[model samples]
Target: MINSSAFQGKKAAYFTLGCKLNFSETSTIGRLLGEMGVVTAAKGEPADICIINTCSVTDMADHKCRQAIHRMVRENKGAFVVVTGCYAQLEPETISRMEGVDLVLGANEKARLIQYLSEAWTDKTDEENGLHRHFSVATKDIKDFAPSCSRGNRTRYFLKVQDGCNYFCTYCTIPYARGFSRNPTIDSLVRQAEQAVAEGGKEIVLTGVNIGDFGVSTGETFVELVKELDKVGGVKRYRISSIEPNLLTDELIDYCASSRAFMPHFHIPLQSGSDAVLKLMHRRYDTALFAHKIRLIKEKMPDAFIGVDVMVGTRGELPEYFEETYRFLESLDVAHLHVFPYSERPGTAALKIPYIVSDREKKLRSKRLLSLSEEKTEAFYARHIGTTAEVLLEKAARGKAMHGFTRNYIRVELPSSQADEALDNQIVTVRLGDFNSDRSALKITL
Candidate 1:
């Protein structure tokens, strides 16, 4: 057993690799550790304990997680390693068996990490064994919603109001990793938002596995949650991370268009634009319905930023089907695209389907969609070249320039002469200028 004093005054370093929701959870964990007298390790400082929050979205993601774990063990030798999150829940035994992992925490157990650590640190038998082998994972149908908010970054907070997913897309494992849809009461989320504001946050991005499925247990809708969050004072802006196409209602679009707090930005996932591929993937909305949703958002708020998620080379996606998807996306008025090459996951229904696209074809298709994304992004930026919008400045600076994002999600870079470090979290009006040479960002006319 580690003598209780062995942990005294030791720093802990947290490494998180995944979505916005994971970041929110990690920040919350950091706060909890702070309250326990365990401070976060400063940059380049090795700590006595290291916690890794992992992701398992794709095969590459899994490989990255494994590589991080092995690298951490090699660099921070003898440091107590704790692994948690979706990957841990999926493969607890495998993680615990790794060279230096002292503890492994699953989904429900992750939030209570402090308590687990307290218990393990005091238990002599756990230390004698050199590993904590046995662990409990919350059932696959978790109902409890643990709200999280990121801090330390004053410009934006990723507020996780919802958790889990009910839509089990054939190619996805999130339903098994995250569990059924659930959320806390609206009152709880509003309080969390208020707390974020109290901590000096200027913007809050609502995130979840399936946020549109929120309020299933509380009889509250996503729209209702948005309305309540808007009532909270001090937070100048809020953005929804991503929502399924079918779940993004017309009312939400209209409300955001006229909202005083909600930003004019929407990230909607249209995984595949080909109706045939979408049907095979078990997506609820078809191409027609997805198109109509985009049309409505554009019609109501023409200048609103609309970002889409597109996955290429899924199982059975023929060349013609890919072309169909390409044509569909090209016809849409989206501002940006997140292109992904589909990776088959173990135990997913996608593995059973025949006609799996080859790696060469997957890479080729991904390249095409990425090029299309660039063109669409340039067109979107060009549409607002001369317009003025409020930009929330960020801290990063390149030599004498600072960067920020407009309300509609256009990134702008300007000379530090016009933006001082003191204006990091403040929103300022700046006329949009020409796109950068690469078309990735815009120049601000201050």
Candidate 2:
């Protein structure tokens, strides 16, 4: 039990590094703490407690997480530092040894953060070095499902529909850090979505490590879950964060095309477009199946905005393989490409492969893919010019321009002179105008 009085008026700082899933979890944690009478520390104000949620997808991600931990510690001075998420779950000792880190929680222990904080504050001199570490003994033991629906500092909510991944891809460490696939019942998720609607969330993004692998534990299907969410009242829009190609069924695509709230947007991970590289990465689907999924979506919804995840320069990705991937991607009708250079993760099967792409080669490949992405994105936006679309406006800083996203996920901005915070979170019909000055978003006219 926590002494609520002791935490009253206490200020806490939160820092999240990594995916939307991490942000959702961190927001949930903040909400939990808020219930105990703790408030978020304002900028430049030293907090009494600091929580950091980290990611460990790649070597660069890990490096950034470490840097974040150190900077938080320095900024907060004597704040009781707490670290959790994938990186802490994978390497607790490393984070625990960092100065001023008072507690380290893991995947299994995150849900019990309040309880742990209670214990820590109650017994001031409980452990040597003043560090308390609690994590699952192994990845398999991380089975508890922590449901989260939060909209931290944003108009749109992020609902965590599923957690953990069963697919242990060759170049990934997610399965090791997050454990096996698991999810709550569909009814529970629907209730959470309703709760989000009650909290003024008009849009929701379903987030997960392996969303399509949603029913491994519940025996329900992802399509079934989607159907249930579509019926939830007050949610004007919903987007599937990312789904694997093999699990993105035709039935799901068809439902989104005709559903009441589902958006005409999809983010599919096609890590490598080359069949050989896919095989080497132990991906379940081939290039042919991936192309079929893309075609299916386009057939059902012609104006859909499709985004792809492509990794350049992984193990066994010879020059020929890279070219194959580039050519394959060029043939696809995706609107954008999220290109990342492969970083070797420890304790993965990728180490067994001998071929390695040099740093310079990786940069070149990444640059080429990025250029292709820009060309495709510009074309996609150009096609929508002068067209009418409904955009969900977001709150903007005072005296600044307001921005929002269309049903198809196109970002559109309103001029600063005409925009005001009064129109925040309202869906308005606007004519898409020319590209903004930066080309990052399309300007709009009422």
Candidate 3:
């Protein structure tokens, strides 16, 4: 266990769940905690506090959250355990009742966690993990959801210009866990983007629970944010992480296609290809419409990288449904796939349904889709052989040189130029080469 006095200087441990957005927010929070002179302790040893950034996408997420707290207590019996994130935002009371959880912070309260802890911290009651004022957004107003994002790697930062969602899809818990769609003014967002660039961020991913809704100004929309972000200097690329098919507007697609800073990459979620399954899942877009969007993106930029999110094993998905999804993806010109098996979430309409996919069946379906993803990815990589692509050199590799991603999203490792820290953010053109002759990151010719 971490010696109690070791934390007199302030030591912390962090864990996160859910999407890239969660990771981004956790990093932001960790950075804020660092400003107060707290250093992160390795897990298992003891620490001043164990701050858990959680998720509520599924019941499994909540189970893991609860399990983690118990495990933390087992390892460091008297450590202060704090819980926050979407799960806390939805069920602070639930967390408050847990044996090991001392502080349960919701969406808003989590932002000032360190300040709160500093005010109430006491070595005398580490085991008396009490609950905090629940700022859980479960029943709160929608537009009230606060905006936050993450600086995953120094080169790529996720700038959350918006938060919350308006859609009440039957199988989704986001509206309840998060709230309604809320966004920041373009001017405010532009200022933040400028600061991120000035802080050495080479790329900014415009993220949000719902980014398509970014706009507070009259008739303002995400396009305006993209157009303005494209106009910003310093960053070599700006990638739109993901968007709903209906929201990936002609205007937005065209902007990305033409913008010098925007890369030709798009990831759209198509939960299922069968209309029957989609209807049951409450997805707004259908297979036909989803396919059309893919076609349009390919027409504009043949080499543009396209990724699709497919969820298998939903309630209404029959054996035929899996075939339908596979055929749909096979027909697309996408470069890769992110396959997820549908999991039940408490309070979500999905859990009340009678038709359920077995875990074994779900695993089989997931594996089938993932195998196809590898083939599609390999096919995409094969086309790039011998073609020169632009790569942003990040930090070191397994042992030797630096590594980075091409504008199209291919991972490549290049020999170290160790050129000043300037090489950290500057985009370098490299010819695509084969994997290390032995076995390692795919090599590139500078």
Note the clash tally of each candidate. Answer: 0, 0, 5
Pairs in clash, predicted candidate 2? none
Q: Which ranges of candidate 3 are over 4 A from the true structure?
A: 1-8, 42-45, 73-78, 122-137, 142-145, 149-154, 216-219, 397-401, 415-422, 436-441
Model 2 C-alpha lDDT per residue in residues 1-446, reported as the tens digit of each score: 67888899999999999999999999999998899999999999999889999999999999999999889889987677889999999999888888778888888888788888887875545654446555455898998878889988989899999999989999999998888899999999999999998888899999999999999898999999999999997899999999999999999999999999999999999999899999999999999999999999999999999999999999899999999999999999999999999999999999999999999999999999999999999999999999999999999998899999999999999999989787899999999999999999999988
RMSD of each: 2.4, 1.2, 3.9
Give the per-residue lDDT of model 1 (tens digit) for 1-446. 32345455878888888898988888887777776667778877887778888898998988888888887777776677788888887788888888778888877777677777767654534464346553655556455566688864446898998888888899998777777888898998999899988988889999999999889878999999999999997989999999998899999998998887999899999989899999899999999999999999989888889999999999989999999999999999998889999988999999888988999999999999999998888888898899998999888654577888999999898866676778778889999999866667889976
Off by over 4 Å in 1: 1-8, 122-134, 138-141, 152-154, 397-400, 417-419
Which lDDT value does model 1 have at 1?
A: 30
For model 2, the run of ten residues with the poorest summed lDDT: 127-136
TM-score, per-candidate, Cα-based: 0.95, 0.98, 0.89
Position 101, candidate 1: lDDT: 80
Poorest lDDT segment (10 consecutive residues) of candidate 3: 1-10
Q: Which residue pairs show collisions in model 1?
A: none
Better candidate by lDDT, 1 or 2: 2
Error of 1 at 234 (Å): 1.3
